[model samples]
Target chain A: MLETVATGHQAKVSAERGAERSLLSQVPLLSELPVQDLTRIEQQCRYRRFTADELIVDRDSPSTDLLFLVRGQVRIVNYSMSGREITYEELTSGAFLGEISAIDGAPRSTGVMAIEDSLVLALPRSVFLDLCTRYPNLALKVMQRLAAMVRAAQDRILDLSTLAAQSRVQAELLRQAQAHRNRPNAAIIEPIPVHSDIASRVSTTRETVARVLNDLARKGILERCKGALVIHDMRRLQSMVSDVRG
Target chain B: MLETVATGHQAKVSAERGAERSLLSQVPLLSELPVQDLTRIEQQCRYRRFTADELIVDRDSPSTDLLFLVRGQVRIVNYSMSGREITYEELTSGAFLGEISAIDGAPRSTGVMAIEDSLVLALPRSVFLDLCTRYPNLALKVMQRLAAMVRAAQDRILDLSTLAAQSRVQAELLRQAQAHRNRPNAAIIEPIPVHSDIASRVSTTRETVARVLNDLARKGILERCKGALVIHDMRRLQSMVSDVRG
Candidate 1:
């Protein structure tokens, strides 16, 4: 059954039934569902793959599917009226997209693109909503996720509005570090997008980001290794943000 | 029944039963509920009044109730690490507050304060969630409201990131204008919250907001009345934002 369902692109083959079910179980909202319910959900999902830079959803287009990344990473962004891209967020595997539009049936407000070769399980909006309605816990989980997103956005707004340019860069770096933190007291953010990408995300110029990173490296707070940026002093970085915010 | 529910100072007396029901009917989330359901919801609510500058909800406090403003206005804001106030949003009559916390059971992330003598109907969070679970349409309506808020926040992020200081001010003004626009081609933003308040909302300095408003006035695009700023040329204001955005 698994092989039959796996189609195209041997580069990133679809997961077998057991693997897919395990993947679904890893999702916070679906984690506690009974096996029967998980199977039902798995039946509704279709696996799809995208190469780097592939557009998954276009802003303002009808949002018809909920996408759960199973492999690789993606970027969520919006283009300004002048065509400047503003990165709203980035998602890695185990993260889902399109909850806002899926709940309200609104057109997509941001464009999502694969940052690397990615695999995702796509569930139609109707099926997702049905699942939420049928499972009260699912509805609560969805609401919790949305609430957390709202709080994160509010914090971003605060940072953009009040923090200075250097502070903004540090703040974003710290945020990314925390998200990817694996060590108890340190964080390694790999393939650190690009200075330009970081600038856009923090509403600063690329030069500013470059200058800030260089300063941090000189101060022994951060180090650049191969394809990643490592934060050596998380406490110092946090204090810097607090000072700027103050 | 209405009289019994009205407590504390009654400079603005509690609304009559018929009037209370009518007001609930006006709320988008409760508008379509059956009369019996509406009455049940109404029964669970109690009227409260806040004097100008009263704190409605404290930041980081446990969220205990959902508030529906029946009269006057409130501002949602967060205090920076330095004690600088940053306005996140403002709500007026017909708007409800605390749905985010009510849904997620998280602490209130921002403080809400009354800008004037205000009347509100308060519903306990547990009851509100119960209502949502029992009424699917009610739950959908709540979800729709949250979705709209998420989209608005995304737009704000875009504006703050890409627009110039002056453009940011103009964009926020245009947004507020549209929300309050009563006539086809005009909008009257009354008691235009102080310049500093507007500055915080748009992430600009008070001096910048004053300068932008002065420029608009000099260009005949806006006129200041006793307690309001009247947009004489809505199209012109709209175009100003579009031009900056573009």
Candidate 2:
């Protein structure tokens, strides 16, 4: 079921019937689908690969394929008319994209780029819509995902409205730490993006982010390692956020 | 199938069977549904009335009923832990609420208050879900609405992040003008919310909003009438937003 069609530095691990079922089972949305429906979905998936910094989908493009990240990371971004880039979100493995455009049949709102060499499974819009129509639970799951997305956006708006620059940077750091935390009472975020990327996410300048981060490091709250950040005192960092929000 | 149940200042307009179907037919989600399915949905709706400024649903309340605004307006707002009020959105007739929480089975994310004496038809969660399961088109319609909501929230975040205080206020006014514009090349926004409310929506102080409005009035871009703001130069106001955004 797991067939290695090509094995090299950049390999293509083709999924057969059983492997496809297992992969679909791991996805929250497709997992609830019945075995037959899952099989149908798997049959429609086409595996694709992109190297780091590759443009997967251009902004305003008419691409409506649903993409599921099989490996690595992708960033959704928008470019202003003046050529300023705003990063909306960074999604890692197992996350999906293009649901909004696919559902509404509108042009893509943001461009998606591969931040790291990535493997993705693309499902055509027709197949995705058919599945949603045939499977009620799948439709419900999609709605739930959309609802959660709306809530997260609202939270971000609240932070941007109320928090100061330093607090916003700190809050974004804490958020990333929580997302990538692997140990208890501490978090080590590896492969951290550059200060400019962080600035774009938090809507601040790179200099501001650097200043706040350096200040935090001086306070013994976090340390910058080779390619990651190690948060030593999460409680202190959390209190900092509360102080600003309060 | 139409029947008049009551007639008073605050009376429940209990809809008869045919009248209920006709009313449901007006809702975007239910309009496309088959007549029989629409009848089923109408059978489950309970007519409700609220006076102006009535608290229809409290934040975090376990109210899962789907509210369809039949007449009048409502505001969705959130109060922060520190008692800061944020107005999320305003809904008018034919719009639906509570779909997000009902889909996710989470507590109400925001409080819904009637901005005017409003008439709403509340559909129980079970009936809503049943209708969704049986009618895929209805589910698709719900997904599209959620998608639109997500996009709007994202737009708001962008405005908050990139625009300055004065520009943010101008952008919000332009948005309102577009929404309530009745005449070509001009707009009349009636019963405008207080300056404090506008400040809350745009994430600025009331004094700043007043200053901006006074400046605009002096420039002859807008005029403050008894209970409405008349925009004499919609193009000029719009160009202000483009200048800031660009």
Candidate 3:
């Protein structure tokens, strides 16, 4: 069902400017901004909420807002001609979205949907432009964040275009394993997401993921623990990643 | 046969700082930089030359430089285990390469090759860091550029993962036609490299490109003009793009 909300929704978005400044201080992009600038940015920011499955922004629409996720999860997705949905990337707290379109005054390339109840700090394009006009440092920090994201996408493109289904799954698992290793004192192995969600990211089907995971488990490379695959041999998995980008 | 010359030939790099500043002035990423800052950046630039088929940068190497195309073309490519090469994008004048890795201090994600005898302005990572420190405006512009690139890649990912071979080819042809429309009015469509090049970019076999072009020719959708495919029906071709991306 399509629901249209009034633009007055903007009025309801209250900014706790002091709180926002402190919160944004923890974010790399905003943290780089001097305290005075951060406070000015926070004063112009507004908070908004989205329920699960609601469209945060529609694809191809003129984007006028920048979103900084404060809570919950989101999925970047698009629809195919067959009416089949393609999930591209998942976003969580601290992630920024829609910045390019907002910055350039262009239409958005993909749609955003909340995967869970989401709270976001939404900044208007006008305010963002004002900040850019006032502070070059803020712009540089934004670019640094964008550059890092683009690099990640480059790695992902290499994997998707070159790797086999099995290798793609393995490499993704290794990526998650490495990410988990950064968390303190936890078992280095991560609780892998459901096979379906994993399939969405790899552009494969759940059946294929299940089959591959089962095979890996049989080989004693990964084990089922608490219904999640726990990687036991990272070297074996790392060897598989090169093949993905070969 | 490998041509053995000095590891680096007379490099033929044109580091004309004034000309670079002018050229960069036209590009959005550097357009906003003050004239003085632009001149400073130009001083830190160096030019490099590469012969056709030369690997300018290999996959997985540390990224220490960013390339600005002054003249000629380069191909951004990835390879599969079975030795199949896929051309992701072609870079011509005004295009920048490796900025993502350069900014992120990460390894190169794809191999860059000189598609023709090419001249490029190479900016070392240290210079980039200096620019970031000296001019935040330039940094923001770089970030916006990176964000746009990421969006472009996301679009490509959707295309490659979801579209069929023939549809992808047709959409690519339409894109090319749009791009060439701005070129000086000419009787002949420009000569593209080969069917294989087109196939690699769209992630299909060369045979498929040949077959599809022939089919389109037979259908009066496209015609051969001076050995180049001249699109005869743009409306029908646009519909194909919509259908593929729908």
Residue-pair clash count for candidate 3: 2
lDDT of 2 by residue, B1-246 (tens): 111223441222433433434566767777777788766676577767788888888877887888888888998877655666778888998889989887887888778888898877788888888888988988999999999988888777777877888988888888888988888778999887589888888878899899999999999999999999998889999999998676
**Model 2's DockQ score:** 0.53
Candidate 2 residue lDDT tens string, A1-246: 112223341123532423434455556677766777766675577767788988888877887888777788999877665665678888888788889888988888778889998877778888888888988988998898899988878777777877788889999888888887776657998886589999888878899999998999999999999998999888788888888765
In order, what is each prediction's RMSD in angstroms?
A: 4.8, 5.3, 4.6
In CAPRI terms, model 2 is classed as: medium
User: What DockQ results do all the predictions give, each relative to the true complex?
Assistant: 0.54, 0.53, 0.49
Model 3 chain B TM at: 0.81
TM-score of each: 0.83, 0.84, 0.84
Best by DockQ: 1
Residue B135, candidate 3: C-alpha displacement in angstroms: 4.1
For model 1 the TM-score comes to: 0.83
Any runs in candidate 1 off by more than 4 Å, and if so which?
Answer: A1-26, A32-47, A179-193, A226-228, B1-28, B31-48, B177-194, B225-230
Per-residue lDDT over A123-151 for candidate 1, one digit per residue giving the tens place of the 0 to 100 score:
88999888777776677777777777788
Q: Model 1 - which docking category?
A: medium
lDDT of 3 by residue, B45-141 (tens): 6656679888888887886687777678899987777777878688887777888677767788788889998776677887876666665566656
